[model samples]
Target: MAHFTLKQLKYFVCVVESQSIAEASRQLHISQPSISVAIKGLEDVFNQQLLVRHHAQGVSISANGRRVYERAKELLRLSNELEQDSREEDELVAGTISIGCFESAAPLYMPRLVAGFKRLCPGVSIQLHDGEQHELMHGLHRGRFDLAFLYDLELESTIVKEALNAPHKPYALLPADHHLARQPFVTLAQLAREPMILLDAVPSKSYFVDIFTQAGLSPTIAYSSPSIEMVRCMVGQGLGFSVLVTRPRTSVTYDGQQLVQLDILDDMPDSALIMAYLRNNQPTRATRLFMDYCRTVELAAVTPLAASA
Candidate 1:
């Protein structure tokens, strides 16, 4: 016989999810004492501290509690699946999946992916949120996102990453008429002489700076923008050139100024675009289906002006 009942597991999971016993009790429509007893019973069964409670603040789940919570979620999922199987075995795939997308990639791929997924599975709906690398990973742990579309840069160990087919190689963004834009491939040393518009987003900023450092050159940064479009716009207006990984389909900025993409003659590292989710957590049916769909989708390659010639 199992030492703990589903009620105990539910209460414990709720406490971890809601981050407070009072909140869990209110959410579950159970009395505080009942929820507290259930939590204590779980700790007694496991013989480990499940939660570290704060007097005035909320509680934090211990390492052991996180493990238990993961397994409990799986158990609850299976149990729910079994119940659903009995009720509607032939039901169509349908659920709301929350996805966290990297801000830079969102504009490039999200619209197409969302539209295609909806067409393929009209029963399913996708809720998309865009954030930086760290924010996306944080949302994954907090159960706010089922999956995240992010680069392989600076990933957490707790995240299980599946690399997509997208190839994200850093390329130079220059005005269509820039003298260097005519070159088949430009080196960092050549571009370093010109003013640079840095993409000043967290990991992106560091990643771009490292490329110059590796090339034994430093750029004269004229401007920095958190917005990728802003960086592109600044470069398009001939303010300066910038290095970016994501290549939008069009080389034109929002203002219709044409920009040019050129391969870096100097060796530069490539970052893989990946789909990441919690390491041990089982994906929902909708999330699993979406992952499958993403694998077959072909990502657009970076288009260089020289290549088109």
Candidate 2:
């Protein structure tokens, strides 16, 4: 069967709102019998009773009728909205862009970036998704995201990468009393004999380990945790120590325990954070607008600092 006509739904709404066929006919600019015939035709197609008539009281909608009326109104509203949205998108006044986010980037980088983008591009819509490095990269590869932030992205031959922030140098997290804590910076050789807490979820752990290997120091992993918070908490308690490249200032603590930021004396890690996009995939205007904004606000050149540990 053909879909119900928009006219039928409009006529139904009028009848329901007026609660009388004669009034509906007057408002709809049609005869009462014509309205009655359309209503009867709809009820027949639905195979359910809708309006019931009483002598002087006009018509009252049944339960099923009320449900259909509500749905029809929603459909009509949505249809109008769809037309308006199409018009805006065609004019580049409104559109949607999806972005992929890495764990560290979203926490420290994206909050301000998004707010700024919205101010410049008020008509565009942004969709945000947060995930680990590999997960975010996968989304970018699959075209699931228009733009993405990934860390230490060892690129294939076809991807584009741009430096977004300063290279985050890894530092040894140690208690204030530890002998290594006295130095302005710590080297891999200095902490080689000590136990270390490794954060499994950190994408840069392997790179940091490689930095140690090149320096001829083998770290002994005394504890392992998947959560960054657990790693910080363990480091604070002096259970063990770890090397972190990118950490929020809020996580750096000068309170409970005396901690030192020992700069790695070994060869620094090569993985620098970057904003990447597929080389072959042409970006939409909205995507380009957002990318430009990240580059703009980032002109202040935010540098990573070591506060405590």
Candidate 3:
């Protein structure tokens, strides 16, 4: 019998993360119908309904689908690393590594890391792919990414996790004219009165939820959106303030919009950026070198003064 191919595994993982054909297609740079066909082909091979579809609500994985997802992920990871492993060991210092990321780190950190890594390892190349938490995780598991920057995910037996840096102080991104903008930094308690923007229902989303829960108040949320830019734009437009893990990059205009900083009542959450890769997968020399770069980068300590830069 013809077995599943790596291409099929990738499509499965993408759909699982995106939960919709159209979204996955757009992300993978494939046509929607092609993504649909790949998924149906996998279902036929497994002889089970890997995905359960709801017309309006989108798609979700079935119990059986989860099992396939986990195993296919490991296999994909193995295949991705195999080529890297075979390259000349020292030559491994040269080549490219793919990363799965989010707006949380991409805006500010990536530039610094890339520049620092380039200076140190002149031959290395980096490719970054950005998405939300679920999408990032799915790409990591599917072996499409050599590594990723993710929140502290509860990892599985076949994956390795390394903590990089703690989450920055959570702050309210507000319109420059908002009342809270007048203060240098406001406390979490003061934020209670304002309507806010927050993330959706996911592990990382729940983490943010807990931050508010611990504060002993539910937010007056007037807006909820998945895209980081949308959330920032909404908050910048005076729609509402946002409690986000990442701080604003600098005092600059975004799409001709202005943003102000508001202080939080509490310290930032204890969340950290982690480097995740398959445990059993043997990364190439390039991947290993990249991993070392992630661990050792000397990020200048960011403070309110640093934030203004």
Cα lDDT tens digits for candidate 1, 200-260: 8768998999999987888899999989999999998999999988888787788878888
Residue 229 lDDT (model 3): 71
Can you write out model 3's per-residue Cα lDDT over 37-139, one digit (the tens) per residue?
A: 8889999998999999999787999999999998987777566566556655645456667888665567667777778788887776788887776776667
> Roughly what TM-score does model 1 have, to 2 decimal places?
0.74
Which is superior by lDDT, 1 or 3? 1
Q: At residue 86, what lDDT does model 3 achieve?
A: 64
Q: Candidate 3: misplaced stretches above 4 Å?
A: 1-92, 119-125, 153-158, 299-309
Please write out the lDDT profile of model 2 over residues 46-134, one tens digit for every residue. Answer: 98788988788899999999888878766654554464456665574456677887764575677778888888878877778888777
Per-candidate count of clashing residue pairs (backbone under 3 Å): 0, 0, 4
TM-score of each model, paired residue for residue: 0.74, 0.63, 0.66
Error of 1 at 161 (Å): 1.0
Model 2 sits at a Cα RMSD from the real structure of 14.2
User: Among all windows of ten consecutive residues in candidate 3, which has the lowest summed lDDT?
Assistant: 300-309
